[model samples]
Target: LIATILLYMGVALFCGCGHEALSGTVSILLNYFDVTKGPGGGLDVFTIIDILKYIIYGLAAGFFVFGVLLLVEGFFTTGAIRDLYGEFKITACGRCLTAFLMFLAYLFFLVWLGVTAFTSLPVFMYYNVWSMCQNSSSMEGANLCLDLRLFGAVTVSEDRKVCTGTEKFSRMCVSDELDLTFHLFVCALAGAGAAVIAMVRRITLSSDCS
Candidate 1:
């Protein structure tokens, strides 16, 4: 009873009062790693919420797979599954789900990391080039830079200012794909979160059974 009462209080604290505004008490007390606007309000940085989403997704997928298995087992003869293998249990199922989620999270993290890294190619090779003279750098033997923007949509002048016409030393390329990369990164984080949740569920199930 005490445990139950404490749990309820914890939930109430976590969720805040029904009448209270979400942005009010919750923001003040529970705003742990929430990301707001980025530099100059341009973008939002990664936050704990993004990771939580991934974990939730993984947990959801685990539940879905468990449901499917239940349906399949139901169709099978009562002891058929046990006869072939061993007695199936929800705790084991949860662990399996956690493992699957972890695998998916690893995959997503790899892909997100790869894409984000590749997208940095332009920045490394050359960020700006002369748009008018068609060369950003006067350095001899420098590799001609790859233009990220449309062929003629923009250019950089010798003064290093952006302009419309073919200005020397204009930006050779600009990255717009990073936003997508960021989104993917966020998804990968969700996968990570799912893995965590699945593991937690596995532990909880084990404890409950014990």
Candidate 2:
């Protein structure tokens, strides 16, 4: 167990070490994702250290998958299936524990999804667009002034005039509501499936139920 944990930690470090910093618009998203901090790198830069932020995160997630595989593989070799000291077999207990815990996890996830779907749903639906607008407009996707002109958002000129129909100096605000709106569906579906597991059942601690 100790060795496996150490191995995982080592892999994690290696995965992060090569990633170098970047700047500019890419860095803007990276920073927002908490991939890197501070200002962007000075200018065009490249090296072994300049690892793509997304790639680093992907590799980190992969390391976790590998670590889980290692842990589960331990189960068959040294886990529930294997006997210790030729006297005790913990396979039954381990199996029961695993099932019970997994079911609980499923239920918890469902409840969490339901809650998140409720929260981010309205913000992206255009009804709540006013919350972001500096003015009285409460429409979603209201920040396309410089991009689109026919939307509900408003932009102003240098003299405080409403940008009613011109595209000179546009004003816009960005929102993740649309993306969250889509995610709401995915979360709802997964949550409903998890609910189908119904309630968690009791697992027998021993190989025999009696």
Candidate 3:
């Protein structure tokens, strides 16, 4: 039994490693998603470091996928399934509560995915236009006067001015901010799922009466 536990531990460790790698890659890609330089790698000055950022991002994404699979393996190995089954066989209240918990978990994932999809389209358009605005213009992308116009969209109120004259380079930062929002929502859903699983099942399946 100890040996089996050790094996599972190893599997969990492997999965965790992959997850971290992917997360790191995602961070790197997100960090430097936009890059442009003038001729001779000197005038405008963006270099290989910028290029490697995307590669790291891809690598991290791959590992994170692997890590998620590993975590799933750990979940089953830890007897989460058996525990749920045992809880289902208890009193009527226990069964109902378990069902509700599962439902919540499902609902959380569905809501998160729905919102993410809905948010993605506008974000894509913003990033593309922002990128074009920055690259096409001689001014630095980060400058408030040249490349960013999206911020104007954020503060448009009936009482306020139209404020249409936006700089061109602000989209990268806006995109990053959006990514963080999605990450926060994803983390919240995951937390809710974990809470439901941990709270709903009181008895182990091994304890169930035949």
Computed on alpha carbons, the lDDT of every model, listed in order, comes to 0.35, 0.37, 0.38
| 2 or 3, greater by lDDT | 3
Clashing pairs in 3: 21-60, 22-60, 25-57, 146-168, 147-167, 147-168, 147-169, 148-167, 148-168, 148-169
The number of the candidate with the highest lDDT is 3
Candidate 3 regions exceeding 4 Å error are 1-89, 137-210
In angstroms, how far off is 121's CA in candidate 1? 0.8
The TM-score, computed over Cα atoms with residue i paired to residue i, of candidate 1 is 0.25
lDDT of 1 by residue, 109-147 (tens): 354344335334322322232132333344455544334
Clashes (N, CA, C under 3 Å) per candidate: 24, 4, 10
TM-score of each candidate structure, all chains considered together:
0.25, 0.26, 0.30
Query: Per-residue lDDT of 18-67 in model 3, one digit per residue for the tens?
Result: 23433432443344333223356652212433443364355346534533
lDDT of 2: 0.37
After superposition, the stretches of candidate 1 with alpha carbons farther than 4 Å from their true spots are 1-90, 126-210
